[model samples]
Target: MRQILLFAALAAVLALLLVSCGGTKDKPVPTEEDAPGKAAYHKISAEEAYEMMISQEIVVVDVRTREEYDGGHIENAVLVPNESIGSEMPETLPDKEATLLIYCRSGRRSKDAAQKLLALGYQSVYDFGGVIDWPYELVKEG
Candidate 1:
């Protein structure tokens, strides 16, 4: 009976320690919590994304290969190849809280990248479709 009591006491102490370390409700929320593990994805128009780009400090990301990006892409889009987003985020985008605008040659890569970005803890991720659907002028990297 004494041993059981001691084990119960230890368990209670461990539970308290775990609760304390879990995190406080009053603490500042993590950026990743807002958009975690592909649970968040916003589909917006190219025009809307462009407008936001002009108005906000957003990161426009191209989730395609270097060759695909060199062919033609929206001006000022940082390359974060889709295959490179696991364990750690792409070097091009370190801020998990940044409003990320992602795209690719077609909608598929953009969709995949958007989900991966969310999984990597990006707070505000927007998938504005692909360059193929973009009506805006695209510039080729020479």
Candidate 2:
């Protein structure tokens, strides 16, 4: 009887788990930050980002400081410092539904800034890692 009860309990737990961990057919593919009270953002490669920039009307965001941005950045990239992002929507990023491609000097701050932008209700946000990984040419501010 003891062994039977143990098997029954194990089966019950397994059934519960299967029900709880159901398929996400209705929901979009979730990112690492996708969770309760958290936001979701896509992490793409620099090459992918470049393609998107040319193929579509997307916003390239440089989440680095003014000094860093002045040094060098992708052509047509807008400077939106990560430190400046707050609860309110930034004036520079007026369109919440516009596709945003965010990057930083070393990829860390870009991810952080992407999450914040999603939380701010931005529909499409992508982090293409750090500019250091970018093999393409970068234009310097005059």
Candidate 3:
């Protein structure tokens, strides 16, 4: 009886350990002041982006092809294709401390661009998904 009780206790302890070590929880959204080398971008909704656009002076970046951009894009959004981003900072975007709002056609490239910008030390980067999700008016190229 004593041996059986010891084995049961050991099994219970092992199960608890396994449960505790199973997986990690989702990380919280990073802020502008998050430590260097950490994720420095924030994922915001289109509504939130619109609110910010109305309330602040932000640099809206369209991380899509020029062809797609010419079709239609957010007003005042600059074209900086994800493929064009290199080791050096983009000339159009000179201020690393400025608030950057990024978007792509379907949210994939925007995320990639936002991460790259953050890695490049651009503080206050916000990924507001894609332009398809943007309900606001778009400006077409002349």
Candidate 4:
């Protein structure tokens, strides 16, 4: 009887361990509803980005190469190439809690940069996809 009780207790402990260890591996997708100090990042549309740009003070980041940026980019957008970002926080982006609107030539780099920024403790990061999809006016470098 003593042996049986010990075995039952061990089995219950093992079951609890297994239950606690089981969890989803997938990352949570950030939504438009995500606010600063709440979520890591938010995926928004070009129109939504435009509204935020006009209505509030936001840091518009073009996460593309210098050459690409020189070709043309959204007005007031600063060049902060995705390749330039590393483990260290970017110098151009000083404030971690600032509202950042990130973009690239296409949607891929923007997503990657946004994730990196979030990992660096940025409180308010928004990925607005590619500049190719931007219908608004662009400023070309001289």
- Output the number of the TM-score-best candidate: 3
Ten-residue stretch with the least lDDT total in model 2: 23-32
Q: Judged by lDDT relative to the true structure, which candidate is superior, 1 or 3?
A: 3
In angstroms, give how far residue 3 of model 3 lies from its true place.
30
Per-residue lDDT tens digits for candidate 1, residues 83-115, read 888878788898998899999887888989999
The clash tally of candidate 3 reads: 0
- Each model's C-alpha lDDT? 0.87, 0.91, 0.91, 0.90
Candidate 4's C-alpha runs over 4 A off are: 1-38
Q: Candidate 2 — which residues are off by over 4 angstroms?
A: 1-39
**Predicted structure 3, TM vs. truth:** 0.75
Per-residue accuracy of model 3 over 71-101 as CA lDDT, tens digit each? 9999999999999997889998999989999
- Give the TM-scores of the predictions, in the order they appear: 0.71, 0.74, 0.75, 0.74
* Candidate 3: segments with Cα more than 4 A from true spot: 1-39
Q: CA shift at 87, candidate 3, in angstroms? A: 0.8
Model 1 off-target regions past 4 Å?
Answer: 1-39
Show the lowest summed lDDT stretch of 10 residues, model 3. 23-32
lDDT order, best first, reads 2, 3, 4, 1
Residue 96 in candidate 3, Cα distance off native in Å: 0.2
